[model samples]
Target: MSESAASYKQLKEEFVSGLSGGPVGEIVAVTAVLPIAALVWCLLQKRHAFFKPYTALGNVVDYLLNVGAALLAITLYANSAVLLMVLLLVPALFVLGVPPSTGARRKKPKLPPAAKSYNSNDSKDDTGSSSSSRDFDVLSTKPFLTFFRGSMMVLTCLSILAVDFRIFPRRFAKVETWGTSLMDVGVGAFVYSAGLVAARPVLKERAAHAGGRRAMAATLPRRLAQACRHSLPLLVLGVVRLLSVKGLDYAEHVTEYGVHWNFFFTLALLPPFVAIFQSALKIIPSYAALALILGVTYQVVLESTDLKAYILTAPRVDLFSRNREGICSFVGYLAIFLAGQDTGMYVLPRKINPRSGSSNATQRTTLLMTMAIWCSIWSALYFLTTDYKYGAGLSVSRRLANLPYILAVAALGSLQLFTYCLIETLCFPEFYSAADPKAEKEAYNVATSRVLRAYNRNGLAIFLLANVLTGLVNMTVPTLDASPLASMAILVAYSAVLTGVAVTLDAFDMNIKLS
Candidate 1:
């Protein structure tokens, strides 16, 4: 690298270095806005039928709720985080802390009157026969999970480049080595999401084959090939990104993942690993337990030995040393992935009948179990992150993807899921009462939250587009020196483009799945 380029890289590195981050409560507040805003937006759309009167207004609302609010995850959030937290506290205390409200306002297909997803039964020893299994269903359309995942992706898209500009809050950027930031959602939540979507299929496979070694042997080659096919796209993207950054002398941060390592490569490596051990439940039984074992064992390695030191300080003479951070952090991400997969299984049915009280009972049983586990996770988080010894206060490292980081991801991800479920249950009653779940799901998707569906459909494609746009803007415009007004204008326009494309693609049923 040239001297001036080297100096510029140094300046960029220093700017993002050593940040301890703001209160975790504030980060949670930023997270709170996503589900709250999405639920509110869905409600408003259901009630107003805004698109019927004015399509443009509906589009704007989608932008604000999906992409615009996601931008807040990285910027403008630290300012009024307390207010958001206060708003979140009221509902959280009522929803998770106390008995779930039994009163659900019933509405028709237009609004699907209520969710009542978390209500406890009058039967003290109720068998798990309840509609609460599909907790965030919003019933057929899945607005909650779709919107939730889209927001995370958009926020990541915005923050990856937003950190380069002066207008973006430095505190929200990825932390130097440890602590938390809004951007710290990073690959943990993301890979967790990937796992969430993959969970049902894995379960189906396990059930069909009965975890037989012979069955796995028959499917293993095809699974590995399919995984490789998916991985190829990501590998190509990683190589292209690396070559472009080096060839163009782009402004880059080497320490972020270390020399020659980028997020794409980190992603590229995961699929094959997943394919190899996708049947792990046969041996470990519970994905949650499996994830905990790997994460705690990795944490032990980091704390008891010199691996962490080697990752942080080793010379980049060989490929392994050059990308130590990404290599080591992969274990953490995989654990988070399995944990997410466990959650995916939560909302699905173990039997064929959607309305069979017996099946519903099993699903509800799973939901309650999930909640129990969720509480234990939070308790573990509190103890592990406490400041006494290797607590999160001192040991949490986004770079390392340490034990504390996995716990935080699991806690926060579950919190978001539960919040959405609570909203769907309270607001949409037709879902559980509907005779045909397949038809109702389609109706809800079309009538209420098509934008979110579109986003969910073309997630990877949109992320790639955002990456391209960010690079173009950085190359053509002086991000670090732009006026605040100009920067805001640019960011809004960027978000608008992303949301617009997603909407348009959904309108046409165009879906792209690139790693």
Candidate 2:
């Protein structure tokens, strides 16, 4: 007899449910390996010359050492406790560019301003991923952003395939509900990342044609059209994904997003919603306040009414009920997305302030202080709202994406992003202080691994590829009973294929732009 969707759901339920996650600090530490290797490899990029005249081989080596290290960090975690601890410590210490005993960090001298020629070329594509922007007041290189995004994507890529295997730890899987886990954190992380990059960019390649002044007022129709332009592709992709899953009779955990809903649809909706509601969302105090308000209101409805019951236990009988989780949880995800934008607003250097004559050191310090404040506030909120603290003793549910989940995401996201920023500051102090956009970008380009940058740039393609490969593997191989050694071997090979594609794409100067 063929396995039904209900059977598939039950199998996965037996696999992932009824478990609280492992220690946050442990997962956080293992994750730190990716950035640590990336940033350090960037600083020591010249060492890759061992493969001179055969640069492709160098890319292979870089992938094995840097990207590959992240895989090993997961599969071999039990065996490398000391190394993981050390990887965790380097970021904690060097982020400050000072010793535990040091009073203050020594500042580096600033580079002269770039000849105004690079303004047009600095900001590239709609993503406004380039740190050197003509639209923003501040412009600095941000490999840290790339590193963080890549790390999360890689973790996601590896875990999706690995989870089917016995060697994959259940504690890291998505909990049934009301608890934290690695996969749960990833859901919020993606929402946060989307908002982080979609912060309206203050970016326009052709702003110069419009009197060379950034338009303070973009019309509502234009905003919606542009948001549609970006988000519609994802919607199309969502439809494609749905068709493929149903056509293949793929086993899907319907509760994840619901019968017809997936993350693509959820993610696609965000840009337009954000476009329509940004002004209202950016209410008093900060963007995050609106996020908190939305989450709290949603939680109140869930708690006060039968909405939570309807969400968790309702039959997938109708269209709305089929996608209830995606529809209802949207409010919480939007809150996370908005909070991410709020973070990007601060972390991204929008415009250079000419009046203050501020050095990058001073700017970094100020940003660090702001991050510290955010961290303290959110961490306290999380503790206070949890069952362990003085409040209602709520549990974090990825399924519901409750207020507690948002709070946890904010607290952890702040700390993680802060660490990434610190890595960039320490890895490339010249980047912050340098005035030449083209030159600083070149220097940054040289220091960071092209392989990582490839994954970072065309992340959507990588994700698509990983998903297809995961399905293919599951169809062909019996992953559920694979031994640890067999699982590790398969995982490493899978990761290598992903990395090789990234390297090849980087070599060809191709960016898939699907993202």
Candidate No. with top lDDT = 2
Backbone-clash count (model 1)? 15
> Candidate 2 at 350: error in angstroms?
5.5
lDDT of each: 0.69, 0.72
Give the runs in model 2 whose Cα sits over 4 Å from its true position: 1-13, 46-58, 78-83, 87-141, 200-216, 281-285, 350-355
For model 2, where is the 10-residue window of minimal lDDT?
100-109
Instruction: Write down the worst ten-residue block by lDDT for model 1.
Output: 100-109
Q: After superposition, how far is residue 252 of candidate 1 from its true place, in Å?
A: 1.7
lDDT of 2 by residue, 237-301 (tens): 89999999888766677777889999888888887888777667445576788788888899899
Alpha carbon lDDT of residue 134, candidate 1? 40
